[model samples]
Target: MLSRIGLRSFRAVRNPVRCLTTKTTITDHTTGRVITLTDPNRPEIADYPNPKPELAQNKDPYAKYDDPQNRRNLNDPVNIDDDLYDMWSPDYYQFVSDKTALKHNAIFFSLVFGFGAIIWYFQLNPEKPAMPRSYPFGGLAKELGSGNAEDDEFYRVKPDTTAEQELGFLDGDKDISSAKESYIQQNADFIKA
Candidate 1:
């Protein structure tokens, strides 16, 4: 039965206790209409019609394309020579400013790159010590030496010539030497006399 009558009337019937409410009244400026906001559920519209200005009947149809202030006209005489002396003109000033900006930027980058190169060179190419440095492992070599100056001299020298011939170890027939051969003899019978 409540569903058939609708929910809004059912709500008023169920709640008999009445509560006093307030209404706000405002006037529309453009249309000069009085508006009363009696219910919170209903939306209030503030929009009004904005009509365009009526154009002059006898005026040119292309007059809309003219500058807003109508300062420049098509019939006005222009001098070509006067443009050269127009130093304060926006276009001329912009070109000159752009050229100067480019020059300054180039100078700044060149100085930066030059300073960076100088710093890089000093960092990479460090000054050498007046006296040459001794071998780091020379102490170990000296301690293990058998007191042979010529043998120990190899470790102390800058470029060690520790090849076989330099150490008096010949190329052929290692068995001929008094010392034992370094390599094992795989086929002693196949050895050439």
Candidate 2:
């Protein structure tokens, strides 16, 4: 409490929080000095700033190509002079050609690999023994004589109905053969069972 008010009689503090803050004091052999300082790095505002005039009274010249208010039409064909031909170094064209050649080589290799994969899939798989296959109707598909789609539909035997489908049969939507097959199987005298 005694150290807080020992340095200064009064402080110009706008906030009550700062007024309560105690300044640190340093003591040396020569004499004790109490330093009261603000932040040294605080920036001063730049002098002679352009004052913004009112929207109605403002008069500024329109910047030609960059005026956003009235932009030049993009579709207009007006050729500007080639002032920036030397924008890049002389060797830049060679570097661009090298990059283009690399890109074309990469595309060509990718196409070669893609064509190789397609050829392997179509021609090579048939020669291999264990090619993947699904027999939906029990390899009976090969027994069809003509192998045409029309004859296969007519001649193909009906696949057995699953128990779950027969159990879940709600109404007339159930297969007409389900009841007939069940009746023949239950009457055991017809077959050699």
Candidate 3:
């Protein structure tokens, strides 16, 4: 003997969720009709009329020839006519040649002037005698066996004093005082007395 068993519940399961695979149909805004073709997955296929044979092989007005081998060769020499060269007069060549000669003459004159100026300058002031510059401050001190301060003091001279007084002043001679006193005395009579 076999026993029969019954299901406790018979609830139907919900359909499984699917992603959207088909795009929405596009429509013209003015005409308000579907502008795009219907889905291809449909059982009935729509027939598309073929385009005219003459219009099918129509070329673009802006399209250029597509032959890459017909490109210009840069290595080829330029073509010039002998008649074009003959059009120029002989005087034109002479003018260009004369202009070149003038430029050469100008350059030659400039070089000659520069050399003359250098020679004249050397002749006016020879290299041997450059006024015999006095020794520098401390240099003169070493030469004279004195301090730079003493050498500087010796060189400074008053306009009224004579060269003899200046020499005596530098030598530190006692005669300098007597000489100054006598000179002052000689000039004293001429001074509004």
Candidate 4:
């Protein structure tokens, strides 16, 4: 019975010892340093540095009644109308106000119309021929069509011949027919071989 009681107390002591053995790291804010603690019996507190004198002395430099620089002029303030009129003069501040208003108005109108123009441009039909409808494939299409007369796949695989017409190589239906004949004659070796 006594041995069992001794074992129970030993077990309790072992659990508390394990809990106390856990370690923690802490930082000291004052000196920008770190410290570690492992004791469970005492609470740990990290040391911090005190505020410096230069940082603590900062105060408002523009306080009206208490300002050191303006203290001498504080007692001489009897010209109320003159001071108020001077402060309220439209002529004194009109230049900056007018310039800013003009700038803002110009920016507002430019942005409004600029965005509308962009939206309109995007909304237009993409497939419709743009004003003068210039062709892009040019003589390559005409050459391919005439030279590959025996090979139908060449004409079918090539791009449109509209580019040659736009480039003035096909001034009329006659010119287009003649170009087709010329292409076949000039490239006979390449086409037949």
Scored by lDDT, model 2 comes in at 0.43
**Candidate 2: regions farther than 4 A off:** 1-96, 124-193
* Cα error of candidate 2 at position 83, Å: 33
Across 1-193, the per-residue lDDT of candidate 3 in tens digits comes to 3233222111111322222233434443333445333433431222222222221123243444342232223442222232222223132232458789899999999999989898897785555442232233433544455455756556533232333343332433568888977888999977664
Q: Which candidate number has the best lDDT?
A: 4
lDDT of 3 at 64: 48
> In candidate 4, what are the lDDT values of residues 57-171, reduced to their tens digit?
1324464543354231344433323333332333343246878989999999999998989979888536536433343444244545645545555554444456535544434
Clashing residue pairs in all predictions, respectively, total 0, 0, 0, 1
Cα error, residue 142 of model 3, in Å, equals 14
Flag the better candidate by lDDT, 1 or 2. 1
Query: What is candidate 1's CA lDDT for residue 178?
Result: 28
lDDT, model 3, position 129: 45
Worst 10 residues of 2 by lDDT: 12-21
Taking all chains together, each candidate's TM-score versus the true structure is 0.16, 0.16, 0.19, 0.20
Reference-based lDDT, each prediction: 0.47, 0.43, 0.42, 0.49
Evaluation by lDDT, superior candidate among 1 and 3: 1
User: What is candidate 2's lDDT per residue for 1-193, written digit by digit as tens?
Assistant: 5456643433313211221123332222122333332322221211222233222112243534343342333443322221222222122232458789899999999999999999887875554363233334533544755377667766565444453244443454356578767887898797775
Candidate 1 residue lDDT tens string, 155-192: 55442334322444344465555243423254456666
For model 1, where is the 10-residue window of minimal lDDT? Answer: 46-55
Cα RMSD of all models vs. native, in order, equals 27.1, 25.5, 26.6, 22.8
